[model samples]
Target: MPDIVFKSVPFSKEDVTLALESGVDGIITDAAHVDGVRTLALCDVWAEADMPSVALGSKAEEESIAARIASGERLVLAQGWEIIPVENLLAQPAVAGKLAVEAASLTEARLAAGILECGVPTIVVLPEALSSLKSIVAELKLSQGALSLGKATVTEVRTVGLGHRVCVDTLTLMERGQGMLIGNSSAFTFLVHAETEHNEYVAARPFRINAGGVHAYAVMPGDKTCYVGELRSGDEVLIVNADGRTSLATVGRIKTEVRPMLMISAEMETPDGVRSGAVFLQNAETIRLVRSDGTPVSVVALRPGDEIVCRADVAGRHFGMRVQENIREI
Candidate 1:
């Protein structure tokens, strides 16, 4: 996540209050205001006098600032900064994650974020533009993190009788090979492909995923997971692709109904050894899981020895949050 610092110069108590409530990472204000800001919010408050600043008026000055950043100075605000100088500094291997730019408006913030495609890891926003702080922060944080997906070979598939299955309808239209991560255990999850590919019998539903049984866990943003039964409309879910890239999608609807379910189990080869996991999903022709080649394989057609993509983790979760505990789920 990128750091969002509120510049509280010409400090207004109301603006500081707004910044603190908006979930900004820190506040940069005058030394006299530091104590007052601290009294209101428990966040990093840096006195303006303590921060080093550089005027990017010349190439030499920009290079000097980059050198200082490379030598381990983590926070330096760039004034009169432009795309080229920021790009140049960012291109340097040593200054990759140490730069912060002052952004005057939402447009400037967007430019700062999209520079070099990775953007600066921090941005100091002027106090007057605090009204746009939330949206700006959201735009910066929406850049999805990547996941490491591995191959899992189908070991078993069997009818599991009738059970309640969940169909998640997201507001975002998903591609043919994208969907949510779901499984019985949080440690191992299957990339249950979206119902976007048309079949001879059923029309394509590009926004829906017949995820799994009600008790199954679906991956959420920030490395969390929630039971499919717990999800509701307006909730945010993580939509992942075959290549492990992810983005946030809002849940528009959740349909839970009795359906014939199938228990699908697979084994994955890991550095430690082979690990096995399973998910019970609707036993329908349209329900599918993602294959390694970025194609959707129908659950009805899945057979032993077929390879698919899955994610595994060692941490256990409680109430969708990661927790340290010796826990197991079948």
Candidate 2:
């Protein structure tokens, strides 16, 4: 692909058409033009022109970059991809600590290499010239041109495969929602609405599902996905089963009193007299189970033989439970 540098102009529908005819692969403009350009659906129009556009700001920041990406604008030119205006990517331990092999330099050539290593990605930049990184920048353009054909082929293959897999999984999940205890639960007992909801079976396996509250409990109706959570009021949730089939559920008010957790009671054979090994606790938000030494465990995974401890804590400023493994289990 040929590289065509653009400058800001009084763009109109006519201007965009002319740019395509003139063989412009990209457009470079100030942030001031962004709003007007977007109003024209610049991104979509450019795609019709068989081109991809980039957004250039005097300075690039995370939020702006994220916005541009969401707006279908590809390619961002800033001090560096890692160097956002408000935050230094290098200052972040996560980025700085990354293996040097992965760090892309500020120059064109290095940036191109970074893009190659990053898999033929798009880089957006402003029309202004950077004296410091010129040589590396040139290299990046060269590398991109050289690798375009091969990269497109690889991308096409991957896209087709991924799309096929997702379609199959979605269909399977939708079919399995018929009879399943798709729910979010605490340790004591599986939460259920006694009257409005009840247990059912699929292929003779017992399944207790409740469509309750402004919030309802459900699992995705597919085997490939495993997310069990409460659906908020007016929220839509998917119910999935072991075979990857799914169904959709719309939540209404709680029809009956809701229990908070799944209760499991078992007798412990101790060295002393047989003790009644039973524990009662509300779901995750109330009492978090933790190891004595303070390790987390999955609340849904507590078993009859498993040794566990409880913790008091909160996440996102809300109270919740933390599960820890017991010494015996360790």
Candidate 3:
């Protein structure tokens, strides 16, 4: 993940507090208040004089910036930085994790983080950018990158006996096709639809996803997964849309209840072969899986050969993070 640092040259305690609260990784302050800022919080503090912002006006400056970063110098890019110069610098070799860009607004910060697909290693938010610090961090840091999703055909749907299922109640309201990715394995998962569709029997609870059995793996931010049973209030869960766009939301509450469950199995053609995956979900009228057209289908009505959206990958996860070592879930 790219880092966000706020520049507090004139030094406002309130601004520093806001930056820290907004989840910035570091703060660049002047020398006089180094001790004073340290007293406020245990965050990274750098003297403004030591690490100054570098302006990129010509081709030579790009080489100088790259050489400085390559030779073990940490640089914070000056405000008003352009796209071409950064793109040129990113094209050079060995430039990851050593460069930072000072952004005057959220727009620049977002653009800086997405340059050349990999983006800058760090972002420096100026004082003028403090107003939107929360938004900046939420997009650049909290919102994890893209998730690949595709359609899969359902092969089996069977009723499992009563079991504990998790209902993730997030603070964000979801749309029709927005929900969490959950399954027995992190590699092969289903997009369990959110409770956004209104029915005559029940009103929409757009913030909740009655995810799956307690033992299921729920995909999380940072390309990680967490067991549904272990989810708690305040933990972050990845919210995925049918289009594979992702957003971050805090789990306001976790509702675990004993409910009749259904075991759903699906398969999709992959480059390797026909890949299969399964998920255990509550067998209720409201619980749904997304269709390829971004529509929601109830689990009770889902039939064999019915195409629904799923995510498939190589089957190995070590403590939620993807790894190459061989492993299986059945």
Candidate 4:
């Protein structure tokens, strides 16, 4: 993971050095903060550090893709509203680039893939894309786990749990753990954490949620903990709760339904068959079960023996409800 610096903020190199001692991988920022003679200059000051730099386009239409190059920022975030064509995005070689598409549905994921094919190396999906983790995991071919180090970089072997030696970059993880490393020590309002144990990620620290009910993870959904494990249908996924108790769900099926929503069919058989045949089920809360008549029954209300197709819309919907047993872990 890279260290991210926002404009008009105060940070210290000692703190960044501490992050390097901790295990951060890289850094992110724009031209505004990188030009100062402050402590941030020492932040990722080492050339050998695994720290990759990303420059953020100031405005959507700012034509200065070279700002990062001029200011020494290596990686750049193509502002979401920016109209840089494929040629412009590929023309820049000073930085490894990522695109911000803030997906609220499946249409965004498909569009993201189309953009990737156009040459962007990275894509950030918004909160809406969290529900479609399986689809995104598959689409991105993300087969490894990620670990986040708050504010540090490493260059040597370090010891952990059992005589096991591991390498710590600016951020370090076992490479297969679904963990997150957060940067920046300010803005308590935008921090985020897994809503449940069954969530795609287990937070490294507590995240701040806003009055609007959106957390940092939801706000910059693309800037998130990487997913670990092999993605397949029928896998029991677990999302951890705020209290740390995990929720469970089975991957019943995966199919492209409407543009942004990937229909995930999960069948839940309760002991007594409760919410079966209830009407009034709407788009997200509705569950469809195959009945003897071969017609689908809508489980709008809580009932047993009612099996419904859980629609995991990539366009953005409530998909992380880790409130069950036998769930899977991201």
Candidate 5:
């Protein structure tokens, strides 16, 4: 995630308050208003006149800016810096976490932060973009890397008597194709669709995902994984959509109850030949998985050859963190 700075140069109190309320990382104001902004919030206040702003209109300037950043200088990007120069600076060795760009709009901010999948370390938003500040913050802050989701053919689905299942109630209401990724192993995970649909028997609990058995592993933000049994209120979970886009959601509560359980097994073709994965979910009408067409398929209706979305990776997770070692999971 990149830092978001709001530029309130010439000092508009309304704009500064908007920036503070929008949860910006810092506020860039003239030296005279640094105290004013500080009084508003304890966030970082950058002296606009003290920072060096360079316009990379030529190769010579680009090289100079890149060299300055390589030498540990935190430089701000002036207007008229093109995409080519930005890419060139990003490509320079040892220049990570040393660059800043002033974005004029949310689109530009998103592009600046999404460049090379590692954007500039800081984004300064001009006051002209006040209307889009909240949007810019929410997207650049909440968004995670798009995952690599593929299809797996269901091989079996069988009842496993009574067991404890976990229902993850999130602070955000998920849509039809949005849910959590869960599995017995971190490497092979299945997309467990949330309880967003309503039927005659039950009302829609769009903010809940009756995720799976307590022992299942859920893929979370920051490349981490957490067991469903260990999750608690106020924890963060990654909500993944069928298209692989992910966003962060706070765990409002964790509900564990004894229910009739079902085990779902699937197989997918991998570079190391076919690999299998399994997840234990509650045997209920609301428990579902994502299909190839982005529709939710109930676990009770799953059959052999039914293709569902899944993610496969190298099989190793040490204490919920990915590790590279010669380890086998059965």
Candidate 6:
């Protein structure tokens, strides 16, 4: 996500308050108002006197700014910054995180964010654009990017008696082919389809995913995973579509109870060989896994040799954070 800074020069208390409420990363204001801004909310405060402005229309000026940035000066580029200069500066390895741009409107902000496909990390929004700050921040932060999804062939599906299963209820209504990626191992995750399809027995639950056992790993943002048991209300989880496009969803509720569990085993074809993983989910008609064609197949109705959507990685995880290790779980 890009760092958003609100320019509070001409100092409007309302703008400062809006910035605070909008969750901006920092506030650029005069030193006298720093304390007042802090009294409203705690955030990074950049004194107006300390920020140096650089005219970045030419390559020579950009080089000068780059030199100052190398010396630990967080200089701000003047507004009306063209795309070529920003791209040139972004291409330099030394200017990775040392630059900020002043954006007068949302278009400039988006342009700064898309430069070189990895735009400037920080953007200072003028007070005039404070009214649109909330939308700007949401647009920058909610980008989920893409996910690497693979195919896994089902090998077994059998009942494992009664066990505790977790049902994740998210705030967003998922589409027909959208769900969470979960499994017994962090290296391999199955696309456990959402309960959005209606059945003769139960109504459609577009916001619920009968995830899996408490021990299973549910994919989280930042390429991390968390145990189903660790998820709680207000926590963010990754909602993946059948095409591997992902988005963020907030957990609204987590239901755990003793239910008959079904163990599913599947093998994924990797460059080395076929690797297998398993997930234990509730043995109920409502619980389903995604087929390769984006169809939902209930756990109770699943059979061997069925092709399902899954994701496999070689890196192991420790305490939900990915780590390099030669560990295996089955």
User: Which number leads on TM-score?
Assistant: 5
Q: TM-scores of all models?
A: 0.65, 0.22, 0.75, 0.24, 0.82, 0.74
TM-score of 3: 0.75
lDDT of 4 by residue, 83-129 (tens): 34433655566543533233345454455445534534444433333
lDDT of 1 at 177: 73
The CA lDDT of each predicted structure is 0.87, 0.29, 0.90, 0.28, 0.89, 0.87
Clashing pairs in 5: none
lDDT of 3 by residue, 1-330 (tens): 688998998989999999999989889998998888887777888989767898988889888888988987878779878888888887877776677899989899889998998999889999998999999998988777678899899999999899999999999898988999999988799999999999999999999999999999988887788899999999999999999999888999999999999999999988888999899999999999999999999999999999999999777777888888878778
Residue 116, candidate 6: Cα error in Å is 6.6
Residue 16, candidate 5: alpha-carbon lDDT: 94
The candidate 2 region of ten consecutive residues with least summed lDDT is: 148-157
Better of 2 and 3 by TM-score: 3
RMSD of candidate 5 to the true fold?
3.4
Per-residue lDDT over 62-149 for candidate 2, one digit per residue giving the tens place of the 0 to 100 score: 4454454445544333333332331332233443222111112334424433432342233332223222223333344322221000
Give me the runs in candidate 2 sitting further than 4 Å from their true place. 1-72, 75-231, 242-330
What TM-score does model 5 achieve against the real structure? 0.82
Q: Judged by lDDT relative to the true structure, which candidate is superior, 2 or 5? A: 5
lDDT of 5 by residue, 1-330 (tens): 899999887889999998899989998888988987898988988788766577878989888888888887767897556787888788876876678988889989988987887788888888888999999998998888699999899999999899999999999989999999999888899999999988899998999999888989999898989999999999989999999999989999999999999999999998889988999999998889999899999899999999999999887788889888887765
Candidate 6: lDDT of 86? 82
What's the residue-level lDDT of 163 in candidate 3? 95
Candidate order by decreasing lDDT: 3, 5, 6, 1, 2, 4
Q: Model 1 off-target regions past 4 Å?
A: 1-139
